[model samples]
Target: MIPRLVATDLDGTLLRSDGTVSPRTRDVLTALETRGVPVVFVTGRPMRWVDELHDDVGGHGLAICSNGAIVYEVADRAVRRALPLDRAIVLEVAARLRAALPGTAFALERTHGFAREDSYRSRHVEPVGTPHGTLEEILDDTVVKVLALHDEMDGDAYWRAVDRLVGDLVDVTWSSTWALVEMSAHGVTKASTLALLCAELGITSAEVVAFGDMTNDIAMLQWAGTSYAMADAHPAAQAAATHRAPGHDADGVAVVLTELFDLP
Candidate 1:
């Protein structure tokens, strides 16, 4: 059966290793959109980090960002929906993680921008946001997600340890190659958000195809009827996917979509 929708991740799945979309991939997606099958960029990136990607989506795709905490409408350049983390829950989670993993720093993803603790070290050379006071002082606004950065371990190791400590309390996931973990409200994930969007579009999970390369994409991949993990996807993501495609450098998603849709 032909898929009615295509959902994909950004960092290690859709974008090339150097962080740019290839023309072939862009053209194929445009053709897919023209055929009435829309593409959705489901990612761990905050909205502020995804602004430049508007055109690649052809001004028609919806972006499921912040691990499903936000749904951004590409064409309108507006937020269709925002699922914020509860202030009390966030504070509790932060305190718990801090106690368990001493020296760990925290950051917050606000509706419009990002804010981090004074001691948090951002992996990005370009800082994600300004230093707000301690996590306690940053609760005046709604928090969509929380970023946990640990300087003593790798991303995979940190995620595993964090999950073991706080997995039952909140949703913990990591997408990048840094020693950082992202937390969302329990039950909030890319798959959950995408499922809602699918329903709104009159499409079912069985009619959707998804792609990803990180642990964050595991749920989304498992939820889709047909799921692809990029060749270099994280172990968990690869195992969750029904199939595997070339890595992002090879335009894995485009290759799969072309075969699925028989596009030129």
Candidate 2:
């Protein structure tokens, strides 16, 4: 079917493992929009990381960042809307997880900045003098998502344990190969916010095509009428997707898009 909208995860689904967009992928996405199929990047990335993508994505497009917590206006570098995590909820979740999973370290993603405990090892470099504090010390109402980390556990294992402990209380999902899980307020996910936007645009779920390669992308993959898991997608993601696209390194999403739309 010809889709009205296209939703895709950035890191492991669209972008190559080297974390850059391939030239072919870039052309395909731009051509997709040129043909009137808009692309929305739904990622676990914070707005900070998505900044580099504005020009690459044809200058102006919307992105669902921090999973579903923030909907960003790409060219404008503005937050169109956000579903921030309540600080009280973050504190409570952190308290409970710390008790059950001894090594879990906590961090906060806010509208304007980030803060983390000394133990949370972030892969992306934070600015010097970024806040380093306890949850009680650093948490504020601006929090968009809560990050939990464990150096010893596998990515899936860590997510499972966190979900088992607190999934009933909040939304827990993992995208990183590392032992990191991002928690959103209950019922908030990439699909939830995407649904809101599509409704605003008068698009239906049956008109949306989505792609992803990890646990975090499962909900959207399932929510879309048509979905593809990247070739090396997580087992759960593969199971949720209706089809398997080529691997990210192979510019898989682009391959599928070109075929579907008959783009050059």
Which is the leading candidate under lDDT? 2
Off by over 4 Å in 1: 125-131
Give the whole-model CA lDDT for all candidates, comma-separated. 0.88, 0.90
Q: State residue 256's C-alpha deviation in candidate 2, in Å.
A: 0.4
**Which candidate leads in TM-score?**
2
Clashing pairs in 1: none
- What tens digits encode model 1's per-residue C-alpha lDDT throughout 1-264? 999999999998999988888998998888987898889999999886778777676465889989999999877878999988888788788888889899889888888677888888877754544757788877645788999999888888899998898888778998878889999888899999999999999999999999999999999999999999999988889999999999999999999999999987
Cα-based RMSD of candidate 2: 1.1
TM-score of each: 0.96, 0.97
Separate clash counts for every candidate: 0, 0
What's model 1's lDDT at 73? Answer: 81
Of candidate 2, the 10-residue stretch with the lowest lDDT total is 52-61
